[model samples]
Structure formats: C-alpha cells, structure tokens
Target: MLEFKVNSQSQSVDVDPTTPLLWVLRDNLGLTGTKFGCGMAQCGACTVHMDGMPMRSCSLPVSVVAGKQITTIEGLQSKTAQAVQKAWVDLDVVQCGYCQSGQIMSAVALLESKPKPSDEDIDQAMGGNICRCATYVRIRAAIHAAAAQLSA
Candidate 1:
C-alpha cells in the first residue's frame, strides 16, 4: 500500500509501485482533470503539482510520490490558481480544451514561482507542455493576465 495526500486529502492505494501517477489519479482516485497525452512525459499533458512543483504525472511513478502532497487541477485552490483560471476564462484560452488542465497547472506553478513572469519566463516554464490546438499565444496572454490580476 502506498499513501499520499492528494488535493489535501489522504489517499491510499494498493497497486504496483511502478504504476504511473496519472493512472493512479484517474483510474484509482477518479480525478480525471489531469489528462494523459504522451505516455513518455514529453508532452506535459499530465502535469500535477507535487509539493508545489509542477511534475508530469504520466511518467511519475506513484511510489515516488508516496507521502507527498499532490495537487491536481481539480484540487487547485491557491490564489495563483484562481487567478490563472479566471484569466483563462477571461481570455478564452481554451480551444479544444483537452490540454487546458495541464496548461493551467503549469501556469499556476509558474505564477507561484514568479508572480510576474516575462514572456521568456513563461515560454521557458511552459515549453514542455504541448497544446494541439496551437493556443500558445492565448496561453501566454492568460498567464500575463493572471499575473496582473494577482498583483492587483
């Protein structure tokens, strides 16, 4: 049995330690907001925050996250997260909406780490996440808008 805190709640699962955290969150925990894109973690579609740092859940083993604080898009409650969500909505950042969760997760993490990120900072932080709809421009704008909202 492996134990971890997800969305501020204690959770325990009996499964292979090597099971990717994405499956654990989706199949076991029923938290489907974190999407699975590329199983190899290059796409960043399954990003989650482990101890407040953005991590690709699809490639991360559940065992490695035991006893850690894991926050999925469903459980994001921080001010930064709220700002990002609002900015996303205000900017109409969602195209296909499949990758928005991961994008929001990464955006929240970036804003948390750098409240006022530059375009370069946003690019560097969000480089790993791939949006099939090509909404990078809107995503960037939303991040900046979120930063502005947070600062106000």
Candidate 2:
C-alpha cells in the first residue's frame, strides 16, 4: 500500500511499487488530464506538479512519489494556474489541444518559480514539451500574457 496526497486529497493504492504515476493517476484515480505522450519522458505531456514543482509523471514511479504532494492539471487551482489558463484562452494558445494541459502545467511552474521569465527562460523551461500542431509561438505569448496578468 502506498499513501500520497493527490490534488489535496489523501489517496492510497495497492499496486506495483514501480508503477508509473501516470497510470495511477489515470487508471486508478480517474485523473486523465495528465496525458501520456511519450512513455520515456522525452515529451512533457505527462507533466504534473509534485510538491509545487513540475515533474514528468510518465517516468516517475508511484512509490517514489509516495507521501509527496501531487497536483495534476485537473487539480490546478493556483492563481498562477488561473492566469495561465486565462492567458491561454485569451490568446487561443491551443491548436490540437492534446498537449495544452502539460504546457499549462509547465508554464505555471515556470511562472511560480520565475515571475517574469524571459524568452530564453521560457524556452529552457518548456523545451521538453512537444506539440504536434506547432503552437509554440502562441504558447510563449500566452505565458507572457499570464505574467502580465499576474503582475496586475
């Protein structure tokens, strides 16, 4: 049995220790917003916040994250997350929308850590997330917009 806090809720699961947190969140907990893009963590589609820091859930073992605070896209309730979401919507940042959740998660992490991230900082922070629709321009715009909104 493993015990952890997911989205501010206490959760316990009896499963393989090495099971990736993505499966546990999607299959066991019904939190499917954290997508599975690349199982190898090359893509950031499975990004989620572990203890307020962005982490790739697809490659993280559930046992390793036990007792940690996990926050998925579905549970993103921070003011920064709200700003990011609003900015994404305002700028229409999503194309295919398959990877927006992860993008937003990464963006939120970036903004939380660095309130005013430069282009290089955004690029370095969001370098791993792959979007097939090539909406990188809009994503960066939205992050900047969100930062502006937060500053207000």
Candidate 3:
C-alpha cells in the first residue's frame, strides 16, 4: 500500500508499488484530467506536479511518490494557474482538447518556476508536450500572455 496526498487529500492505494502514478491517479483516484500520451515518458501528456516539480507521471512509480504532494490539473488553483487557464481559454489554445490538461499543467509549472521565461525556455520546457491539433504556437503565446497577466 502506497500512501500519498493528492490534491491536498490523503490517499491510500493498494496496488503494485511499481505501477505508474498515472494509472493510480486515473484508474484509482478517478482524476482523468491527467493524460497518457506516450507510456514511455517521451510525451508529456501525463504531466503532473510532484512536490511542485513537473513530472512525467506515466513513468513515475506510485511508490516513488509516497508521502509527497501531488497536484493535478483539477487541483490547480493559484493566481498564476488562473492566469494561464484564462490565457489558454482566451487564446483558444485547445483543438482536440486531449492534451490541453497536460499543456496547462506544464505551463503552470514553467511559469511558477521561472516567472518570466524567454521564448526559447518556453519552447524547451514545453517541447515534450504534444498537441495533435498542432497548437504549439498558440501554447507558447498563451504562456507568455499568462506570464504577463501574472506579473501585472
């Protein structure tokens, strides 16, 4: 049994300790907002915040996260996150909407860590996230716009 706090709630899950945190969050906890793009961790679709760090949940084992704070898209409720969410909505950054959750999570993490990221940093940090709709350009723009809103 691995125990952890998810979205500020204590959770005790009985499963293979090696099971990826993504499965625990999705199948066990019913937090479907986190996505699974590439199970190999090449894609950032399953991105989530583990101890305030952006991680590829698909490859992260539940055991590794025991006794840590895990934040999913549904748990995000910060001024910066709000700004990013608003920018995402205002800019129409979602197409298929499948990767939006991960995109937004990654964006929030980036903006939180680096209040003002340069275009290259944004691209580098957000590069792993894939948008089938090809919304990379808009995603980058939204990140900048969100940063502006946050700094204002």
Q: What is the lDDT of residue 95 in candidate 3?
A: 89
Q: Report the C-alpha displacement of residue 28, candidate 1, in angstroms.
A: 0.6
Return the TM-score for candidate 2, rounded to 2 decimals. 0.99
The C-alpha RMSD of each candidate to the native structure, in angstroms, is 0.5, 0.5, 0.7
Poorly placed runs, candidate 3 (over 4 Å): none
Query: In candidate 3, what are the lDDT values of residues 1-152, reduced to their tens digit?
Result: 88999999999999999999999999999999999898998878899999998999999989999999999999999998999999999998988899888889999999999999999999999998888889999999999999999899
Give TM-scores for every candidate, taking all chains together and pairing residue i with residue i.
0.99, 0.99, 0.98
Candidate lDDT values, in order: 0.95, 0.95, 0.94
Summed backbone clashes in each candidate are 0, 0, 0
After the best TM-score superposition of candidate 3, give how far the Cα of residue 89 lies from its true spot, in angstroms: 0.6
lDDT of 2 by residue, 91-143 (tens): 98888899988999999999999999999999999999999999999999999
Candidate 3 structure, TM-score to reference: 0.98
